[model samples]
Target: MTQDTSTRTHCPYCALQCAMHLQPGDDGTLTARPADFPTNRGGLCRKGWTSAEVLTVPDRLTRPLMRKDRNADLVEVDWDTALDHIAERLLTLRAESGPDTVSVFGSGGLTNEKSYTLGKFARLALGTSQIDYNGRFCMSSAAAGSVKAFGLDRGMPFPLTDVGTSEVVLLAGANPAETMPPMMGHLSAPTLIVIDPRRSATAQAALAGGGMHLAPRPGTDLALALGLLHAAHIGGHTDHDYVAARTTDFDRAWEHAAAWWPEHTEQVTGVPATQIRAAADLLGRAAAHRSAYILTGRGTEQHSKGTDTVSAWINLALALGLPGRQGSGYGCITGQGNGQGGREHGQKADQLPGYRKIDDPAARAHVAGVWGVDPDTLPGPGRSAFELLDALGDGGGPRAMLLFGSNPAVSAPDADHVRARIASLDFLVAADFVLSETAAMADVVLPTTQWAEESGTMTNLEGRILRRNRATAPPEGVRTDLEILSALATRLGQPAQRFPTDPDTVLAELGRASSGGAADYSGATPQRLDDGEALYWPVRAGSAPTPRLFLDSFAHPDGRARFQAVEHRPPAEDTDPDYPLLATTGRLMGHYQSGAQTRRVDELTAAEPDAYVEVHPDTAARAGLAHGQWARLTSRRGHTRARVRLTPTARLDTVFVPFHYAGEQAANNLTNPALDPTSRMPEFKVAAVRLEPDPAP
Candidate 1:
């Protein structure tokens, strides 16, 4: 395509979803230029710049592959052959083991239309309730906390521009410098307070600019938040009028906070009372002027007590009277490209389109009507992502599985066990652009179109929906996910008309399905998106896009946010004698979620050649480990070996590992599988592990 014919799209990697222009070169290569989008004003991360390289990667899947039997090798097959084989096996499995024996797993990376269609296909075609997505591991805790406190969930209710307007920005467990480098440009707040265990890139950047960094112990975010709130309450920093006017359960929440004074919290969190008080003072001053924001990310929300930890932060926001203000409130720094819209448009275990509860009678009838199905025939919520994976080989669990986009074998916590579970499945189908670790063992793998080769809508971290125009055509033999879903649904006896291959047609259905629910998107038509306008959800007809929310009230019936009385709880697997160091996992600057697509990019691979453990100098010396020395990290679940990188960034009692690599360096192999009571999130951020010097060559 010529320069003038370039298509405007967004990055396919992170939730920042920075806008960019793509021109397909005659030589089959693609060029990307930063678009002056509001979220990222004409800026792109390294990942975004190199995103096009993935489009023409030498190993990009161009044809479907299927294995004839358990011990057989995967061989290339035609689309029809692959679909028919998968359909026949699914039908046979359903007949032999019942509908509940078929499960579908999805990803947050999918476009809004694709996610909606996947959820519908699993429920209507397979008649199974065991459907969930990899997003459950990403930001479900924040979603759960938002719903509980505000009766709804949107990553950032206000626009990203508000970050620069806020007087004080308190970022909890988020390191945007490495995760979303473009976002740091918006960090113009006078006082920035970052809470994290490690001296992360974001923390260091903030520190360099005179911002404060509170290095709390790993898994102690809840206690840290409680401590901050308690200090604020004691210092009379809380807005009593705002609390009384716009919230409930204040007394109980205050009582919970009172129990954890700064001293007690210091014991639990390892953040000093003086630092807590200073943070409280800054937040209080900002709150007095109605200019503060409390934002969270996976670092604080990927724990067994993730939901409660998020709730504690929400309580602090509510106490400060942040919500309902113009530019101040609690928000989640969503990690996936479409994570906000993915969960809202369905694909979550307990949700329907429009962010409605699946078990709710109104939601059931509304969505069922949109699908032309009987409401009574619809199933209730099923097991969460990890639970479903754990049950794959069980007698009563699903026997056949269909996976889309997600690479759980590399991404899931306790991944070694998850891989074994995948191996035990009677049949498996994977639809992806590359042969991810999860796809390698699948009974069938279907080649699918990449983001730039397709047209769809993706809701970014700000809850803004933007159109992704097709910049180029996919290689022959590969098909869009919509086409694959349509063909597979038809082969499984569903009417072809019900599952159209066009993304616009699917989005139309999605809008209708989401019409009146909490995250209503009825106003977001393909025509509107095609017009190059950005729109946030709760998009009702005849109304303007909601760039900001809760100006007057929340989504709750009482028109007020709720104050959750959350208490501090230790992580499921705490550091002890055998496993004396707290091990936390996170993403690196060069890799996205699982390294499935990013690892294939030569530039990214060159930047982050391999995974390594970040060890505190004290801890490294104690273990007789030197920098670049290979070490073995052993946890209760499993162990992995990686080279040790000594740094003072890590706490003396903590070690950090990047979770991008697989095999012997897989970080998830040592993570805990304990679930958060409310969010069902795995404790990926913290686990107990011991570092041992690897054998010398």
Candidate 2:
């Protein structure tokens, strides 16, 4: 009898990183089953259950392809030939233009090891300061807000289980009911206060649980949060003693909130003043008892004023003395699988490993020492994600680029412009398991192994470091991302020993480089993870893991959380005569970001085959549109078409569309690229758009 072959791993979808077990069948097929884990608790969503299908998708790329010439079709080539050609072009570009002329674009889906290696490769091998990732669009606002308020940024400072013990869970612009079904288990025990313009599934769940749902106008979350703060203060819910002892700058924050009041906020947000007072009362009461939590998601964090918007929410949490408490605090619901870790390990534009700023001399010396290079040899911080994309192939911008694991052509805000910029690149390279939209435009496309074929660590939404083991061998002619980076590093004249392809070795080096930094991981060795140890970050060698941060004191030198004095502002593009309605984009239950992987799965595609916009009946009637009819939504940036579905759950002045499908149906085509001044996050959650009936047959 043959022995059963199975391996334990995690899902490749969202930030929850639900644990799963993969078993190989006799007929060369694989199946995924939920495994007992802290985050998912042995439950898997449809996307998680069918994740194995992506590994064996029919159109999976297994060989290297290169464009022989400009305006030529891509042809299959050997690994050496592809690498040699890419190296030659990169060297020429660097010598003729400058190292800054070549850029690297990473993704949030990459494992910690890959993210670290990619960052190191961009700095050491390519000698370029231009490096950033799609994570900038995911939770940069929340990250910035958290760092400003608490002196550090972790998606969740506490374990996912903490929600179960909370009396109130205020979800600001977060919809876990559809995006992460398994997470709803934790929400079941807490009274939810959901804030969103549309009466989403999460809002419905809140109502079912006898909780409140505040449907504010799109991009007015900052005002709503300020009103909540004002009401909480007026009701004597402020923990005055706690604030005085554990926080600072409250006077300024209070002054700003004092002017908002409930009435004024109601006018801006369109949420009833009475509802604002009630919601504030619930949160204040819960926090007074030390059983409340506040959380923000992409909807509130993807705006032109996204950082300030998040700061407004953080100020409210701090006013109630939420941070540093055991059961009560503020957190962000990270979207991508490794979004938290990806930023910490140096894939971001302005960060080094361990979440250290690239511009810091001490951080440079520490990471440089680990790499056995001079600190001065490292480049300084460069442009952010959107800035990098917008500058591609332009004068004084990056002329060549190396991209991995991101489909910016579909996922980027103002995607039509991004596609044109990608097309303008003098040279481009992309590494992926399949030919994604961005990869299809590459001068060289290198096929890389999928998640199940690689063993690495991914930091989940709760900041817990989890290990995913290799379940099966990769297809022939394909390589792991580590191997690809290692080969490229060697081709670029870097020592082979510096770019080790082994995940374990790279992780150890990463720990060494991250030692003494903010996100210290020196103690999280491969052996500890193999021993089934649940490790969180900042785990110094010979010390215990920190499951919850700020339990006693914050990370700042004064050991006090800071209250940011922020004000609400209109979105980058407000409604006008040309565009009378607001359009917001989000994920669907069956389709993940960009739908590059999930769309290939037969079951998921069957469930949500096409992109559709949700419109209120009144709004549809006013626009002379009928339910299930295709409509054209036009914005200042561009336009897209989607079948309209009339539902009362939608606000009369707003429309909702799922941003998964690509091509003409992609919602991102209409998204604005106006960036948050601080986080550089595009205003994806709110856009001025006009809907009209499509006359096309």
TM values, all candidates: 0.98, 0.99
C-alpha RMSD of candidate 2: 1.0
lDDT of 1 by residue, 560-619 (tens): 899998888888977778999999988888999889988999999998888899988889
Task: In model 2, state the lDDT of residue 198.
Answer: 89
> Candidate 2, which ten residues in sequence have the lowest lDDT sum?
390-399
Off by over 4 Å in 1: 1-3
Q: How many residue pairs clash in each candidate?
A: 0, 0
User: What lDDT score belongs to each candidate, Candidate 1 first?
Assistant: 0.90, 0.93
- Residue 457, candidate 1: how far off, in angstroms? 0.3
Name the best candidate (by TM-score): 2
lDDT per residue (tens digit) for residues 162-278 in model 2: 888999999998999999999999999999999999899999999999999999999899999999999999989999998999999999998899998899999999999999999
**Model 1 Cα displacement at 279 (Å)?**
0.8
